[model samples]
Target: MATISEATSAPASEAEALAFARRVLRDEARALAAVRDRLDGSIVRASRLVHDCRGGVIVTGMGKAGLVGQKTAATLASTGTRAYPLHPAEAVHGDLGRVRDGDVVLAFSQSGETEEVLRLLPTVRRIGASLVAITERAASSLGRAADVCIAMGNVPEACPLGLAPSASTTAMMAVGDALALLVARMREFTPEDFALYHPAGNLGRRLTRVEDVMRTGRDVRLAAPEESVRQVFIRLAGPRRRSGAVLIRDDRGMLLGIFTDSDLVRLFEKRREDELDRPIGEVMTANPLRATAGAMLGEAVELMKARKISELPVVDAEGRLLGLIDVTDLIGASPEDFEE
Candidate 1:
């Protein structure tokens, strides 16, 4: 056994440490590239088995592979496939009841011989569930037992001692992701479908539609192009939160221009309080940037940022005003958060 100091001893130099880190990354990347090249009929078969299953996918593994299995299951579930992770150790201890007929079991074991995972194979078959094994060696027990075996192609471990699971686990994760994403593409999974599963993070905010976040109905500050600025301000003032800009529309309900509180301040500063009594169209911004109600909230945010504007109007095909999206609503949002 090694002491903490011995275990964490410094390398010859910082450069050597960085070189070692880079080598580890390069080794793992090479493993993934090899796995990618090795992908063949087995992957397609595994994907089809899971996709056609009447029951949800059950992902099972032991140790580090178990952690990777959980992530794989989560990715599948989020991408429109029903999936859940199962611990092989727990499955033998009565949790095997989770398996059911017509279900697909994805077992992860780099060497294809993890005892816990292998032990569950017979029970999985007994339950009438199909098994898909992901491993480096197709000749191993688990691989032979599986209905389909996805070979990871033997690769050198990133660990110097070749004891820790590094390159193999990375390849397994990459393969799992490939299968899930391919299935998603085959099912024509849409962003809306993804949003349904991820509704509580930056992803949710990005996927949110303009209609879901915009101020609509009476909450929208509306003004006729010909209405006096004074009249528009009086009508817009109230206990309810008011948008910074008032949407100016024509009698036919088509958007004409936008008048903001900033315009009012400018009027006062210019000693043109008399303009407050003038038609609001005289001081309003005409042909402002706008979004459709069905447009993504992130798209609206991007438009606002690019145009250096604080408010965006939601309109219909005929330019009818539907609602308003305020910059304050997007205060905490970041551009990177919206990238797919």
Candidate 2:
């Protein structure tokens, strides 16, 4: 029996270890290139088959191949293909009834001869559905039975003994990703589409709009032209459950300038104690760069970065005060979604 010591001692030098890693990556890349070049008719047909499915693509495999199959199904589903996994063992028991004529069966088997996989092929065909097999040999049972066989070719195992399924699995994953991406491009899936599928993710929250995160109703920072400087200072600084600056507007629905903590401090530094009693219009910055309520979060960040401004006012299309978007709020968001 092989042991961990035998496997550990196989690669005698760091150079050999590095070479093995590179070899696996290079071979997998080559497999992807081959698939790309060969995507002429088979990929189109397979994609169309999945697209036209009345049910959805039912992916199946066994062992390590099953893990890869699960990921492939998810990628397909996320990228516009209606795909889900069906375990080989479970299919044989009773799940075979789930296979419909309008559905496509995508089977993954590195060896192409996995008994569990071979046993499901007849039942897959019995339902009058299409099968797209991803395997290493064209002559293998699964490969030959599939209506569209995507031969992954002979990817040499990274294991020195040719026992572990290293390069084969990587090649399968690459093929799956390539197909998912192509189908996504074909269907013109956008980041907004991805956001719908992945709403609980960080990208979803970061992509969320000013209307989603901004305060409204009684919690909003609002003011009027007749407000005194002392009240504006209290609203803009120190405490209010929210911070940065306060949004001020005239009674006519026109936006007045904002009064930040900086403006308050600067005013106190330059004025007499009695001068603090002046109206807020004296200290507020007039005509600040403002945005609309429906503006994308990404665009808002860009405007902030360009103007070197920390706070921005949100208004309606006709220029009515809506709310405020802060640099600190965007900073709390992820850096990924904010990038172009």
Candidate 3:
């Protein structure tokens, strides 16, 4: 009944278009209100099903609900819920096998009469999987067959003609987000845990480790405490390393402190210039911060930020020095790690 251009656009000024959008948002608010006011025993039962689901969750829908289902599936998967989207059409082909008895199925539809979604309802029940439905009418096909029906109360469609799907899809998305977040919180979903699921995103780098960025092997500044300031300066200042010479115990080769050219002025200011002749113990920082080789760099930044230090030594869990890190040295680390 409509041309491609007409389908793509509506004839109206920008202000009129904005008014239509406002009306749609109002309808969405009403839909959210209705869903909240009508929530009953079904919500508790559905939550229980989700809690018991060891095999994870599968959310399915048709039409607009199907698009919302994809976002819901992705959110749940990212938030430690182990969820995936199962298209109603694809279920008939072979995707039905993805659902096991231990999985929870969430079916969403405004009219609850989508033939694609309804067709999968019987097999979902026959397979012994628990089902939860979200729809306006409790007696709707999908609603009636569900193990638990979430009543989507009477919120008029955002379409002025009351034909297009708008508010219903928004309400369904809110419900999906609520369920995912509730379950994720119950499981104590931490940033570190979430990073495993989102390794390529900014969140993953925010949880990155010091070992991932610190200078390793030959690039690390390591030397005995007994080394001459001249010899240490040759190795440290010669290479233009951000970190100065690190002093380790001569006997066990364990880290003790660090000595930098910055310390030279202060030493010459207070004591004789010849005192630089002493072992690094007298000239180096006696109590330097040491980090375990595997500690998160984000946490290390917190330490450095609080202490206002430029560089720190990396040590093993047993307190043996492995390498060092500096704020300037952060350039070699992943770029995503620096994001706010």
Candidate 4:
């Protein structure tokens, strides 16, 4: 028999250590593949049940399975299905009240015999909430009681001692994600809907509309195409916020061109101060790159990065000036967002 230290000892070589890690990964991958192969109408039925459920989903499990349940619940909620995680142990102590008629109770248990999880079966049934089980066999107490059973089959653990919940939990998480996403698909959830649920992270920022972040009103420097370059700059100099580019608009409020401060420096470099008094339109970049009003901020960022410009004009369908997107406005964006 191996002693605890012997079982936990570091590999004699780096190659050996890497091999063990790779083997563990392979084991988990195989487990997921097996679960995928076993999938049939049960998944479709479970997804439909959850999709049609009028009340929110109540996910319950124990220990590591409970942790997976929490993540599953979060995924479901973010995907447009309202869901909440309830610890099976806590349920017996009054959390069971969270389950109610019209709700779907999603229970997770590898053995299908976790005492805490199984104890909730009777109460869940009594409350009239439909039970959906993610377990190993249909004969298991939890599975037999479920209206829908997504049997994952028996997945061997990836742990060296074969005692930890590694592979099984991985399979459980994947199955949970599959079910949640299927329901999301059934609901025809859109990116706009997804953005509503994730409004604080990198994802939310990337999904933000150009118009939502673009500089508008007095903050945007709009100049008449007939105005002289010198006059446009002079008029825009006193605004509380300064934009790098001045949008040249026709009398009808349509965008004609864009002139940046860099254009002024170029005039000085070329000894063209004489042209500063000319109509700014001739010196401005005509038909400049622009983003549509409802376009995503990420699309604007990609355009600005690709064009290597510091400003992008936001316009409506008829080419009417809406606002401006300054590079400074995206300083808080993730480095990945700027990647091609």
Best by lDDT: 4
Candidate 3 residue runs with Cα over 4 Å from true position: 1-27, 209-219, 233-256, 259-278, 289-296, 302-310, 314-323, 326-329, 332-340
Model 2 / residue 232 / CA error / Å: 4.1
- Could you tell me the TM-score of candidate 1? 0.92
Between 2 and 3, whose lDDT is larger? Answer: 2
Regions of model 2 farther than 4 Å from truth = 1-9, 97-101, 231-240, 250-256, 272-276, 298-310, 327-340
**Candidate 4's residue-wise lDDT over 1-94, tens digit each?**
4466765898999998998899899999999999999988999999999999999899989999999999999999999999999998889999
Model 1 lDDT tens row, 1-340:
4455644677888998998799889989998898899889999989988888899899999999999999999999999999999999999999999999999999999989899999998888889999999988889998899999998878778777677899988888999999999899888999888877888789999998888888888877888888899888887777777578889999888999888778878888999988988899988999988998778888988888788889899998889988899887776787667877
Clashes of each: 0, 0, 1, 0
C-alpha TM-score for every candidate: 0.92, 0.81, 0.75, 0.95
In Å, residue 201's CA in model 1 sits off its true spot by 1.8
Candidate 4 clashing pairs?
none
Off by over 4 Å in 4: 1-9, 338-340
| lDDT digits (tens) for residues 1-340 of candidate 2 | 3366665575779998887678767766776666556545666676666666677889999988988999999998877678889999999999998889878898899989999989998888888888988888879988889988877777766555667887678878877776677778878888767766765545666555666666555555677766787766665555455656767788877787887767767766877555467777765788878878866666676787787777788888888887777766665664455664
Q: Highest TM-score: give the candidate number.
A: 4
Please give, for residues 162-219, the per-residue lDDT of candidate 3 as tens digits.
6687777788788777777777777788876776686654466557666766777767
